[model samples]
Target: MAANWMRRTFVAAACASAALLTACGSSSVDSAISPDRFVVFGDGLADQGQLGTSFTVNDGSVNNWTSQLAARYDVKLTPASKGGWNYAYGNARISQSPDAAGNASTPTVVKQIDTFLAANKFADNDMVVISAGVSDVIANTMAFINGTITQDQLMANATQAGADLAAQVTRVINAGAKHVVVTGTFDLGRTPWAKQIDKEQLLTQVMLALNNRLKIDINPLGGKQVLYIDAAYQVNLFQGNPGAYGFQNSDTAICTSVDAGAGIGTGNNRVNSALCTPNTLLPNADPIRYVFSDNVYLTPEANRRLGEYARDIIVLQW
Candidate 1:
């Protein structure tokens, strides 16, 4: 009953807000806007070795989408710990503690932004990027699977987390940020984890509960200076038609780097993309032919394509 209500609410909100938000389709490239720096904040998808390795096959290439996007502008994205602009960390959520990996010290996206705002100011040429909420979904869904929370409670938590992420994006926009790119959680239902647990439908609802709420909340800003990337839509495209994207396999993971501890919030001893690399790939598995590196993250080829897709959207919009 609650799930149906939330779905109906999202459908209504999405329809009403579609005209106000940026379109999630092909766009012509525009080179009018040039950014001097890209201030990134989020979780494993955007992480660049803040935890010593990315949440994908770290093969000295731009494996993460944020880094892939930065490469298009020739802007190198390194971890802030190493005196660079990328503040994303593995397992980090929007504003929650005890990250998906059960680590309490992992800085949330809110803290990442706070860390930047504490000392530095935004420039007109600065492009602030926020890609998050996947970790929150993973954590909350795992809790429900463990009998720690009911389904309704999980949905409520996802909705609240979406609201929280929206507030953080508003914070960045209000902080004099000229260009902002916001991407909420992608569809975790298509992930290997969902397939493994046979909960694809349930996970799809959980993801929509968060992303749709976020899209609705941010649409009132009138689509100026801020762009929301429909990551779930894009992921669906590539995953559904892997052959068109030069991928032979979209459902299976390429790397087999299982972690001994809580990896990606699923549980201990699950495949962790953080530990993935070229050396850890399964037999006869080619990284370029696969879309996922583990149960939760993308392969290098997929990341590159997604980054280019996002770059096109930014160019066309701004």
Candidate 2:
């Protein structure tokens, strides 16, 4: 009942005042809620060098979305390994092991949350950000394509991962977090990895299933305290019309750096944006204009866009 009331109030108040859905949703506006610290938990997309470097091109820019979001709050985010708030790492799943990069030592999102909760308590001014599920989709889809898991099993795992993520969000909220921002998997079908594996349609279907489950499960938990951002919808808008988003190349990566090992868990000898720098960029390709840094990750500019989008939504709505 409280959640319903909050939802109705938000729609009525925001819609009546803003006069634009984007303003009520994710328009760029000055935020009134000032946070003391940002506690982050997620995979490569939000990782701020937990694995020595971010999953995006390392050009001394605001590469990770988490960092970009923190900048909007006038706060800098560092990895927990570096004694800061961000606990995100590359290729992390919600609760599974052997991450998308096939690294068994990578801490899962469950473990990250456990570490955070054990060490400290949430403050009212703290903003907790949870962005994950892309790695889960990639890992499960790869297993399905390799004949290790059936299509049914793949879909089931995706749905279960989404539920697991929602459970984690509920856990955090119940554990004293006043503000929690959640984002699910993006559209994997549009990624360069999907094209390489020739599983674009299947990946798209699986991604939608996972996000649908997340939406259904997370929506009931929604209020002014919890907000769910549609990452797939944001990515679709970016890729569907790249020109509007200042993207010149939405299909290809700007970086040419390749990892010799099983990087990003697609296979061996694949581009890993963590190793990508200004030196590794392809000739004649503008780093800022490209959407992807590698097969599965966004470039710095794209990350900035998402970060701003997330920040705006939080500001306008919350």
Candidate 3:
């Protein structure tokens, strides 16, 4: 079943790509309106179904915050995110390998930025939104906590991730983006997989440290053109207590079936076992599930808060 789903998803993406190529190949079209084009880059949390076939673990039909914000602000959204992607691939690593045919399935964020710049020149009013670095933390945390990776290595990777993200912001600025918003990492410790691994506290501390490093790095880059949006704070507030936030069944399993587990399991937990017995209990069964769908993705409430943060940053009214 999983293999079948993957094949179907790959076919759909290929067809979509072909259609886009066809559109681009046509004769001259209207380019006068010059709508504000928003270029988005990130991992699973920010990916709006852009991961190809091999990755069938994603929330179905849930539009990412980029699309939501685009609709609200009446701008054009171009999402170029891949699940399980790290900041290095999107920012620094892509320049070394620029061919689309070789890297389309997992094209880096830097490549997407290049494509956006090549296709459309950003005006002074255009904005660039970036959300990345969770994957780095997740990978490092697993290694360190398991005693296979060193603390120094983890910290170094995290610091490099922050630097890479900042570099992407700078590149977007250079590409004529007047407004650039870089989002902070979320509380992945609150996810079900973290609970299962019993590393929630450690991962949380690491995530906070990484976010602080990012804050310090981006704070210096702030001026009239660049801005940093702290999405971590908002998501933390939203997930503090699900009951208080109006979630009734927050304690139950986010996914009720086998396929659901497969989707949600892709985030951080690599456990493919226990497919029949669904793991539905939240952390200590506390009726406040931070992770939303079976794919272990953010819920609508979480994405809505993120959208609000983005809106606030773009409008400078928060």
- The TM-score obtained by model 2 is 0.92
Clashing pairs in 3: 90-109, 90-110, 253-280, 264-295
lDDT of 2 by residue, 1-318 (tens): 997799769755653343233323345577879898999999988898886888888988888888988888899889999999999888999999989978889899999999998879999999999999989998998898789999999999999998999999999999999999999889989888888878889989998888888878878775678887666766776677787677888888788989999887778899988899889999978887888999989998888878877776677677
Candidate 1: misplaced stretches above 4 Å? 1-28
Q: What shift in Å separates residue 313 of candidate 2 from its native position after superposition?
A: 1.0
Segments of candidate 2 deviating more than 4 angstroms: 1-28
Tens digits of lDDT, candidate 1, 1-318: 997699658644643343122224323345577788989999988888886898889898878888877877878878998999999988999899999878999999999999999999999998888999899999999999999999999999999889989998899889998888999888999988899999899889998999888888887874678888777876776688777667888899888998999988889998988888788999988898898899988888877777777776676556
Name the lDDT value of residue 60 in candidate 2.
86
Error of 1 at 291 (Å): 0.8
**How do all models score by TM-score?**
0.91, 0.92, 0.66
Model 1 residue 142 CA deviation in Å: 0.3
Candidate with best TM-score: 2
Clashes of each: 0, 0, 4
The digit string of per-residue lDDT tens for model 3 on 1-318 reads 997699558545543443333223221232222335666666555655553311112333223565555555666454344422122222112222322112334556566566666766667755566776655566567557667778887777666667776777778777777766677577766656566667777767777777777766676665466666666655554456554444544322443334422232233333221221224323343212333543234554456445654554444321
The per-prediction CA RMSD against the true structure, in angstroms, equals 5.4, 3.5, 14.6
